[model samples]
Every structure is written in C-alpha cells, then in structure tokens.
Target: MTKNIKANGLNHLAISTNNMKEQIEFYTDVLGFRLVALYWMHGVEGCWHGFLEMNDSSQVAFVFNPANKDAKVEYGVTNPGHTGGPSAPGTMQHLAFNVDTLDDLLNMRDRIRSRGYNVMGPMDHGMCHSIYFQGPEDTCLEVATFGNADYPIGPKDWIDPEVQELAGISDEELAKFTNPIEFEGQGGTIPNPGYNPDSYNPDRPVQLLQGMFAMPDEQFAMIPMEKRPPSMMSDEDRAAKHAN
Candidate 1:
C-alpha cells in the first residue's frame, strides 16, 4: 500500500534572472505580486536576491549574479549546476498562478502591456482561460482562471471564436454547463487556431486497484472494464494469469 501524504503548500521557487530590478518590478507592478524581502550580500560577489509573495502566501525567489560571466546560464538548463546558461526546454521556463476570474486575468494582461511588454491571449483551454506574457527576465508567465467545465471530456477540435468569448462567461452561467471539450496542443494549428486532439489523451488507462482503495466498491465497479488494464485487477487473477 502506498502511504498517503499531504503537503501544506508550496513555499517558494528560486530562479536566476539576468536583470533583477526589472524582474522585481514586473512581478510587483505588473503581475501584482508583493515583494516580501530583498537581499544583497557583500562578499558573495554580484549576488542579489528577492522574495515575492503570492496572495495565497506561497513565495517565489529571484537571484541575479552579474559576475557569473557565462551568457547562456539561466535556470532549468541541462547542467543547472553551472553558473550561467540559457534554460533548456522541458525545464522550468515560467511560472503560473490561478486567478479567480477572467476579468482579473485580462486586467493583469493590460497592466503588463502598459509596462511595454508584449502580451498574448486570453486563450481558451477548455477547463480554464489564460493569458501569457514574458517577464522582465524573459521568463514566460501565465495567469489563468477556471472558466468552462472542470475537465476536458473529449477531443479539442472545435474551438470557435465564440468559445473565446464564452471564456468570460459568468460563474452562474458556466455552472449550467457540464463536461466541456478542450482544444489540444498550444491552441491548435492556424486556420482552426485552437483545435488539437494530440494535446490531451482521453483514453489513459485507469488504475482499478487504486480506485478500489480510494472509492467505494460500487463506484469502482461502475468504471468501464475496457479502461482498466490487467494490472489493475485483483491479486488472485494477476497471479493466475501470470502462472499460465
């Protein structure tokens, strides 16, 4: 049996940026994060650090090292231990936060744009609406809000302009709907713009054993057998099948 553990919440995430002052300004002035602490060490040589707080009390830290010399050094690089380099893809390129409403998200986008940074979207992602932009340190950042249904129920192949408009739908109206379909990929190929099935997999196998433990037997039985892999079956059946 796997032990159940609970995490209190995220404390903070630290990343290295080229320009500390501009990054701090972007996060505080544009994104609305509050600066909790700032540090500069004397003998540490070109090191500066700042901590920013989210509304939820979670924190993120930024570190600037001016004398590190390597231009390519950045957070999430293949050799992260190295002093300086560009961050590799699949690494931490950005951080995201959840917003309460689409209006709040758009307001943030406008604020960021007013600061002379290019802003993108209010894009629809089935379960959520999001806006993206680059921060002062060239770090990608996103602010999102739950808009449509709670989850993607089918292929994301029918994102219309109307859907984008619907993202700003009121909470009461959004509650009237159920099981929204999400567009796959990073908003799909052009012409269609936001339709990509490859972005989500609807057929991922279910773990029957874990389900049985987590839910009532009746609920487990109600799950489709085809969605359950053989390994999810009872130990008796697994042993019999393996013996054969």
Candidate 2:
C-alpha cells in the first residue's frame, strides 16, 4: 500500500450516450434514479451532460455527443457487458452499486426485474450478497450488500497463493502487502514537485482541462468553447444536422 494519498469513495461515474433524451428516460423512468442536473457540457459546444443521482455523492453521469451517431457498440471490447472480460487496456469492466442490507439487495433485484430487465442473484459470496444485470450501453451493473457488517474482507483472505508465488512475492513482501505504513492526512496545501504539464491521457476528462491549463488566460478564454468541430461530435449527432 502507498502512503501518498487516500481516496474515500466513488463520487460519480460518467458514461457516454448517443441519445440524451432516451438515456435520461432509462435512468429515471426505469432505474428510479432522480434527475439531478442537465446542462451544456462546459468547454464543449453542442455536447450535453446530465446526472442521475442515487445519492448526493453517488451519481451516474451521461455525456451526449449529439453530432455523431455512427459509432458501433463494441461488445466485449468497448463494454464488458454480461461477461465482464478484459477489453482494451483501460476499458471499464463493470460497475457494482452498493446497498446496505440484504433486503435492499433483494429489492433492487426485484426493481430491475420489474423494469423488464433480467437480473441474477443475491448470490452469496460470504462477505457480500450481489445481484448482476446490464444497464444502457451494455454496461454491466451489479448491486451488492456487505453481509458481514462486523468484519470487512481483506486481501489476506482473497489473494491467490499461486499468483503470489508467480509474482515472486517473498514473505517480507507479502508481510508489507498485508500490513503497510499508515499516515494521518493533514489539512492545508500539499506540495507536488514532480507534476508535469505534458501529462495527459486520452481516456480521462481532466485531459481537456490540462490543454486549457497550459494556455495563457486570454488565449484559453478565446478557445472555441462554442465551436465543436465535426470530428468532436458523435456520428448520430452529425447525421441529425444534415437531416433534410
């Protein structure tokens, strides 16, 4: 374990959608998530974003690229679907939502079924009970509850012995992996010395901000936030513009 930083829990998960209206309908109407917000996606013209919330911090966000529509769904490639197999290097395998109790897990399963979607289980895995299903855009979804409230499962119980041996983890390394140094996070501005301006990844939304961050204030402001290049839009959104 690293002592550098600590993350509490998931804030939100965003996924792409071709049609904003229909996606909103599916989340709110079918899944019973409440529409939290809908607005133009900042720094990008013609792109819209919406949020459906299960709670304040737990949200399922959507991005609609109205200008492009021809993008094909890559089953087991772009999305993991039911199988939850490996795709591209950084592909999302699946998302598991949390419930507090066994009753809640059962209720969620029933709700999913009522929405005309088949969901499997309350399959007990000792520590947690889980229900598995699929969501819009072929995203694999799971609802799980911690069955053992007193003791949360740890790596010591689950880590494979064969894999550890293959990785050549010595007893010392295994000891460190099981019990690492802890630090109490302090308040105030922490310093980062190795930060690089050129550090950018195509997968994350923060990359958009990085480009703007490198520019002068005036130039950044003058950026064509209102000008969405055709290449920037989804294929379906592009087709709708030419519909005559």
Evaluate all candidate structures by whole-model CA lDDT and list the values in order: 0.64, 0.74
Each candidate structure's TM-score, on Cα atoms with residue i matched to residue i, is 0.50, 0.70
Give lDDT: candidate 1, residue 136: 56
**Candidate 1: tens digits of C-alpha lDDT, residues 115-204:** 787778888877788787665545667778874535643335444447746787554554444344443443322332232345543343
Clashes of 2: 11
- Candidate 2 per-residue lDDT over residues 1-244, each given as its tens digit: 5455566677788888887788788778757889877866766667778988988778988888765476677866787557557666676788788888989888878888988988989788877888888777777788888864444677857677899999999878998878876765655334333325577434555766556455555664585543564457786865755452
- Candidate 1: give its CA RMSD in angstroms: 19.0
TM-score of candidate 2 versus the correct structure, residues matched by position? 0.70
C-alpha lDDT (0 to 100) for residue 145 of candidate 2:
88
